[model samples]
Target: MFGPTYVFDDPMTLGPEPSSKIISHAHGITSSASKEEDASQIVIMNLAFNDGKFNGSALSVLGDYPFFQKYKEMAIVGGSGAFRLARGIVTAIIYTYNDTTQNEIIDFHVLVLHY
Candidate 1:
């Protein structure tokens, strides 16, 4: 199944200055994973937005890359004290392929929101 774009109950826009956010990798690494699942691929990009009237924004792309707004999902990591959102226009792509050693690798980013 395809993933949702900008996973949140709030609305979003791709405009100038763009809402700023804090992004982090789940593995704490700024690198990419080199594993593919059953010929199926999963790629995620984490964008954070925090400022103005906006609480925050989160975007996730799975299965494929060059994801459109309709294919992204709003990521909610923690709640309340950790409540946050992700925001950002991703012009990047998600790619997955097997290596010679054959390892199931996965890569994604986590956008941390803050006021």
Candidate 2:
């Protein structure tokens, strides 16, 4: 599925817990991979910040995320507002997941450079 077979708008927080500080929101689309290669998922994401200095800025991230791994790194392609011309790497880690609800909590460590 090249289109948004899996569309999501998940909260961006400082920590992995639900009670973590909400700093932004991540709106993204992930392609549904074939059963044999489902371990690594492709994602295109945009993080829209709404708090503090980063308010109104957005970051575009794209990469292949291997969920089973301890950490997955994604590229910070570009951005708007404060993060304009941004380019960097974001390390993602799965914090928690609920099988019944299909809910997941991920932690991201972003190292970026911008104009």
Candidate 3:
């Protein structure tokens, strides 16, 4: 799936800002017959930021549980532009989950230390 990402001036206040936008695309293979089943998935995602920053990663999700006791961390193995040579971590938190719709909202926090 693909969508637009917004930035907020004051995240605590839910303020809005035109900071930058992102286009993301993910390709994956699912082991479950349907989303309602307990399964595992291997996915690769590519992110392109409007400010000329880009990053991509390959991640695996092994459990059907929607809530995590620990934040999931993925490697920022490659990137471009301001994030060139980026090597850091991307932490994921499940912000929301709807069992009826089988929809999940995840928040990602990226920390990059690059040259």
Candidate 4:
């Protein structure tokens, strides 16, 4: 089971968006041997637009990669709520990796089209 997580950052310094916070939850299903393996994985995530704009969820199919590669991209097939009928592309970049703790800090960029 995946627990709730909070992302706290200063978006003014982040350079991408003007939002201050992004609260989200995600659960992943891995068919590959390991996350570091060059195989595909599935992830379901719910993102909260804390600015009171809207909230949405996404189902993404992620691609494989080498450990040295810090970036990855996924396809969002569909979503709900503010993202109803949403389809988009999502990009993820590894910001920090802790080999000892097997933890990593990643940055995600999402571009969506919806009605």
Candidate 1 local lDDT, 1-115, one digit each (tens)? 3332232222123421225232322211122222434222244433333444433433343333322222333333333223343232333322333477543222333344444
Clashing pairs for model 2 are none
Residue-wise C-alpha lDDT for candidate 3, range 1-115, written one tens digit per residue: 1222222121111111223343343332323222433332322343344322343332222222223344666566666565566677667676667799975555666677777
Per-model TM-score versus the true fold = 0.23, 0.89, 0.51, 0.60
Per-residue lDDT of candidate 4, residues 1-115 (tens digit)? 1222233322211333335344454444333334443543344444434334553444333444234556777776767667777788778787767789976666778888887
Better of 1 and 2 by TM-score: 2
Clashes of each: 13, 0, 0, 0
| lDDT for each candidate structure | 0.32, 0.86, 0.43, 0.52
Stretches of model 2 off by over 4 angstroms after superposition: 1-4, 34-38
lDDT of 1 at 57: 38
| CA shift of 26, model 1, Å | 14
Which run of 10 residues does model 2 get worst, by summed lDDT? 32-41
Model 4: lDDT of residue 51: 38
Sliding window of 10 residues with minimal summed lDDT for model 4: 4-13
Error of 3 at 6 (Å): 24
lDDT of 2: 0.86
In order of TM-score, best first, we have 2, 4, 3, 1
Model 2 residue-pair collision total: 0
